[model samples]
Target: DSNNDLNDSEQEMVDIEYMGNNNDTDSLGEYDDTEVNVAGNESDDNDKLSETFDSLDEEQLLFDNGDNDTDDDEFMDDWTTDVIQSDCEIVCEQNMILVVLKKCRGLISMIKRSTILTLYFDAQRKRFKKALNLCYDVKSRWNSTYCMVNSFIVLREIIENLFSNKHQLHITQQQVKKLTNFELTSADWHVLLVLFSILKPFYLVTTAMSGRQYPSIGLAYYLLARLRNFLQQHNKKESLLEKRLKQLLLKKFLNYFDDENEQMELIMLHAYFDPAGFAALTEIERRSVEQTIKKSVADQASHSSISVANTLSITTTTANSENKPNANRNVKRNAMNLFNEFVGDIQYGENRENESKRAAIINEFYQYRKYVIEFNEKHEPDAGSVIVFWRTYGETFSILKGIAKKMLSTPATSVPSESCFSTSSALARKERARLSGEHPCSSVFLKDKIKL
Candidate 1:
């Protein structure tokens, strides 16, 4: 009876969920099989779908709700229907903007147009002497895209007026026909300018991050933090588009940073250990980094102890001593007791180590800061010279020197590797194609050693 009651209650709940509070007998009837039948034969389903599609009219196919207040005539004029002569091309209207820009790419290739623009600029050199020259973007260099867009924006007025002299510019009849629908307007230029401004900082950031001479690892967290802050600041910008772009960029950066932070604990340790970078971190952050380093040291010491114990046990067996079993057991017990003592010693040593490390960190930090004050330092210490300082004065601050050496030895970016690849590519060019096989390695070594 209990099970039956439970079943009835479940059935009533299911009915309530699906049927709601319906009072009509027709609504209470079983649901029709008119809904898509996934279990039906594939061919029959396809036929039914095709029939349904055939029944759809132009009105039914369109999704326009007639709420848009944009002037249809002005929109039609802006986006020419030369490519597809249809009034129903509004679905891909957003994409049509990019399509127009892509078509305008050919305008950059016309020699006559280029010559005229150069001549015009030369004639008006007094007023627009600093005007940027027209340039095309290279596929291999993304920075060139910004340069291209910026140049276009700088010469927007001249370009717009250039259309009046289209015939004198020697634009052929076919070229004119092709470029008819691809003309950029004042509003388009404004949008391009906004985009270029948004991307300007990224170009600068890329150049900064690619620095080969500096200890970029120490600057990594600082640079990324600044970029995050910059993006957040832009999130408060007036333009909704700019704000949305910044939000997306910030989200992506946060996700990347969260992932990299886990992998760069050692890098942060090295950063904290850097005297030049010492001032950049707060006291709390410095303490956290010191604790992380201490934990890593403890882990290494533990592993080493375990390996040493195993080696000693193996050596004892190999010696084949003629000691009695009780004596052997006693030795074993003594060894076990010694191990326990060693563990206790490690625990006690850690407390002392913590105190000593804390003192050392504070002393180095203050000493460096004081030295900078005495010298009236303008810039931080030379990043490239850090390793040299460690090598020369390593005896004075042995622990810090070791840390500096480790940090300096590690390349902060894959730029060196990329530079090598670029060198190899240069060596393998059409004229020097066979040179790569001869002495590419030697060439790279020489190239790296030569101080420009």
Candidate 2:
């Protein structure tokens, strides 16, 4: 029995050992399979990466070529080409352009003649006649004689066509002579003079008459003067009108009038009548104007003294100056000094209890008044009736004052006229064949500043 039992146990041990060997073999096979799968995946990933790099290289070359072509196109489209072309073609083309312009002028003139006659015959059209007359007057003054003459001729043709007059509208020699002898006084001439001065450089009249911006002579004059003064003060020489308005026509329009506070009208009146005698005004004249502006500003300050005093008094008491000892003391001392200086001359309302507030307000008013006087002294307005002028017209004078202040305060140099002219030359490049057109030239000139 013992011998049999031993055999059974030994057999059991042998069976266990065999099972362990089988399990080891299976694990080894699985490990080998995993290693083969990993190697294959790594090889495929390397191939994909190489392909992506190749694609990227091709794309970069295509982009570089495209960039070079775009740069070349931009270079060819520059103003140099235009200027060169213009130089080559100007002499030949100018005469031809002049002829076309003259023909167009003639057509415009004829239309004006028919319109004028029609308006003159109708009472309701009297305003239109006045505007037309104003337009002619301005054209005669600022425009070249050739333009005026051609325009008149065209006007006559248009009128003749419209009227279908078999016989000419006869005007006796005496009537023509009487019309030629019509005279305007200095004051009567002031309005037209100002209007022309503002409109001529800007070319606003042409723009407005074409029915752009309602085409009011008065409104155009006002806007032109304002824009001109603004530009002049900023040292901006370019005009806005040239950029727009090529072939506008007035179908219907609204009339614009100068309001009492219109600043441009005032400035224009001053420019026309006073003529900015800065070059010619004696020291005494300048002093007198300075005194007048000072007095006016002082009067305004005096009127507000009471409110100023109350404000100062309240601020002094309510402010917690103690928290910052040094700052508080300094502020208090300054306030006291200012109070003492103005208290005697300026009166405050009795109901106001705060003395410090009142003093501060008075000081501030005085300071503002002083600034205004100083401004007037540096940039005096042209002599005119102040009541008739608009407050908006003061913008030019104010801008002039600001520029002067900056020049005086800082070491920066003023912009030279030559710089502006150079910009104009570059922008207006006469060489560009396209720049020959008046409207196109104007547009380019206006935008020249942006390039700078």
TM-score of 2: 0.19
- Put down candidate 2 lDDT per residue, 1-452, tens digits, no spaces: 54344323322211101122334333343222111122246554335434433333332332334334422211122334312233443343334333443333333222222212222222212212211111121222224323333333323333323334212222223322322232223332333233334335435434332331231122333344444343334223433321111111010011122333464333332222122222233446444544444454445555577567778867865775645566556554577777877765444454243354445434543443454445446554422212112232334343233322332222111233445568789876755556457766565655557776
- Note the Cα lDDT for every prediction shown: 0.50, 0.34
lDDT for residue 328 in candidate 2, whole number 0-100:
56
The per-prediction tally of clashing pairs is: 0, 30
Q: Judge candidate 2 against the unseen true structure and give its global Cα lDDT, from 0 to 1.
A: 0.34
Residue-level error in angstroms, candidate 2, position 65: 48
Best-matching candidate per TM-score: 1
